[model samples]
Target: MRMSMTDLEPSRVEPEERVVILDFGSQYGHLIARRVRELGVYSVVLPHHAPLAEILRHRPRGVILSGGPASVYEPGAPQCDPGLWQAGVPVLGICYGMQLMVHQLGGRVDRADHREYGPATLEVEEPGRLLAGLGPRVDVWMSHGDRVDALPPGFTVLARTAGSPYAAVEGGDGRWLGVQFHPEVAHTPRGREILANFLYRVCGCKGGWSMAEFVERAVPALRRQLAGARALCALSGGVDSAVAAALVHRAIGPRLICVFVDTGLLREGEVEEVRSIFTGLGMDLRVVDARDRFLAALDGLADPEAKRKAVGETFIRVFEEEARRLEAQVGAIPFLVQGTTYPDVIESGGGAAATIKSHHNVGGLPADLEFQLVEPLRDLFKDEVREVGRRLGLPPAIVDRQPFPGPGLAIRMIGPVTAERLQRLRACDRIVREEIRRAGLEDRLWQAFAVLTGTPTVGVMGDRRTYGEAVAVRAVTSDDGMTADWARLPYEVLDRIARRLANEVEGVNRVVYDVTSKPPATIEWE
Candidate 1:
């Protein structure tokens, strides 16, 4: 594999500029980081109370206070560390972040009689430095019940809406800016442009944070981290793990062992594809045939969550056994590498409640295990991981693999998993993937999976009434798995998938497409 110039760059070398986002438990906190990345600048989402020393360690060029589900007047509402205001970096606050900024700086906020929860028109009262390029009047997305009644001593209200008296504020010679509306969402018109203005004008940040640079910088650090340490990576054949395994291989060569477990719930041909890719990469590889183990452990499990937990726990037990055996032979315990990404960490919320999903990496680990964890892709999002994969010279087939749940087909099968049901769903899912690929839409989707609804529905085939399981094809496009919009598959593509699944896959009499986005419906029904 040929190495790109960017791949040779030092990973620890900080970017020319970065945006630090102080997360306040808002769902959009990660979205704020995504927006900054889209602007060609690196961003990290830290907890609201992250110490000033930790923030300074990143040497961020600017800071962003993310919106949250908190009211400034609430007694226990999240607050920023006092040292943040004096951090000397340009700061932009959104929604609750704005309210917190005001309240912290000696301003007053109150619950309003009329609350804005959707689209609103902001009339610019004063075109301050923050609103220099943004026009006089614009539309923005608003979702808040509280409003700032007054600004801090030196801060001036930059804009206001019908219901909000202090919709926007600027302070500290434009070093500090706050907006009552979210600029990260597309619904807010001119949001990206506004963010760009902040990046270039306010922060004076250089747009050097590209995936190319990331891969170049990360490789050597990954090499050092794995030096003299044998590593075992979980290869799910999905893009995340594939990229992770490939990158680690590039960094440490034979010291890295890629383990691909056949969970029996994977779609048709998935195991072979994973094996072929790892072998092709010339890395030490192990293909564990644990299909029966997974199926037996999951036998009679009807609840989706239960099936998921069972699959996760089973994987860890199997992996732990393998790790111990490998260690016994190799005379040293290896680092257990996982493809855990930022979205997983953020959605899991860095706390107990967020850790509900039995992540095979952290959640599934037994308390008695002793191997150290190695997660190279911990800081990257899914898209960035793919770019790094491409830079590492991995095959497009592996690098562009769609997102698959760790529980595999277990979660996709809505009821008790059975060999017959697995076959039916795999066939249906293959048809959907083939159709999407033929339409040249593979790269446009984050995930495209088929689910066996388990419930039999009445249908007619060959003029005969039949009852069989229903299959629903779900495809979504998302920057991060935190939020997603259902992909709008072309009618022809949908028609082809549905027709093929019904006609080709046995026990599937109905085929449907999931049109619901995240929130009302998660990407995975289970």
Candidate 2:
């Protein structure tokens, strides 16, 4: 496939050198691309069994084999086309990818006597191209049952753990590298540095991928794709959808109609923000304040999953109505642009077809919907999306907005959904967001939102005993939503947020910060 014209621009990060991450049914496969992008190089993630010709067409500078839950010894384990290794691109095999590399290269692997599931220390015996500059011992996050027992020809074991002899290995020629642990996740100490070393030293890839280049390239392509057809985009006011809508408008001037739905569960001032952004962008926009419709549909829903399903279904219904209106007004509506990212596809269990979370556009579409979906950001990560936004001249506040759940505050309410509870949570969440922004930690924190726990306890307010709902503040730092760590917020910052929420927001007694990470706890309480 020929590279798109948009692909040939001087990005903040250069696109000349790129990495292709081949997904092998791993949950964290997309994270690999995200890590690489953070290093200033562009990357694309493809399915494990993607054709070698398809991969080579992009002309990637390097390749990464992601760790999957599959066992390489299994008869039907996911395998790449043999031609991939011969592409001459440097290959980095991770976990299951390492096992597959070993087995394919004539090495031996077997079920370990003891599975390594958590943090483990690895001793680097011989550091070379991959492990250069790293100390002799390093802590790594490991999650594997099968272990590499022997090295293949022309390969040397560079590092090892107590249970696995071939924890880390390198091809004698130094082009291929393998590690049994996942360096893409933060729980693995020095994970970012490990990935940085690979992109800079081993692959000789320069970190030149930037969002500006994406916008310069993508806008024109989008115009071409939507030529003479009416494109409708679902605007959620969040950064992803906002950026997506902005890019679409840039692509097809006045041909894109942005539909903003007031789901009734959004944060404070969200609807106004959406309107301001769309109007400011000079987009052909329609604001549908269907707060009552959404709230009625979500009435009596207590389960978080059920709430999501209800909201998603209702959104499709509203979208379909708008699409019908557009068809009657404009005579034709053929495309529905979405803000779906690479992580959404992977978490939906790429290839294996496991549904992690149903995106409103992906799984929430009604059967009777007529528009074909157009997802431009499907191949890009969140950070890349932000870059594209910056390139498109979006304001910094809108471009760097934190990740919000699709169901909005509906899912943040721990107990039954009520207008009062929603309002309270919104107020509390606003305070937290304001404090973080004031502290200049907004960009560093992935998401920082307040959850309303219906369970209330007694507290003293001005010497008078009172009982109210307890709010919990969840602030996490993450590359992709798959794995995350709680942000180690400064004590003063946390204190400021808590004090403001308790004093300003009514009906809240206590405030707490979530210390848990992704493994034990997801970003959202519900």
Candidates' RMSD to native: 5.0, 5.4
Model 1 stretches astray by more than 4 angstroms:
1-17, 351-358, 460-465
Residues 224-287, model 1: lDDT tens digits? 7767788788878888888888877777778887888888888888878777777877888898
Q: Residue by residue across 1-526, what tens digits does model 2's lDDT show? A: 1232233321122256778888887665777777787788888777888899988877888889988888888899988877776778888999999898988888988999999999988899998878878899989999999998888999998999887788889994888899999998778878888888888888897676667666766777777777778788888877788888888887787788999888889888888877886798788879887889988988887877677778877886787789887787887776777787766656545554356666555555555555566778877778778888888888987887788877788888886787888788888988998888899998898998888877787889999998987889899998667778899999999999888888988888788888999866767887
Global CA lDDT of candidate 1, please? 0.81
- In model 2, what is the error at residue 525, expressed in angstroms? 1.8
Q: After superposition, how far is residue 38 of candidate 1 from its true place, in Å?
A: 2.9
Listed in order, each prediction's TM-score against the native is 0.90, 0.82
lDDT of model 1, residue 92 = 93
Worst 10 residues of 1 by lDDT: 1-10
State how far residue 106 of model 2 sits from its true place (Å).
Answer: 3.2
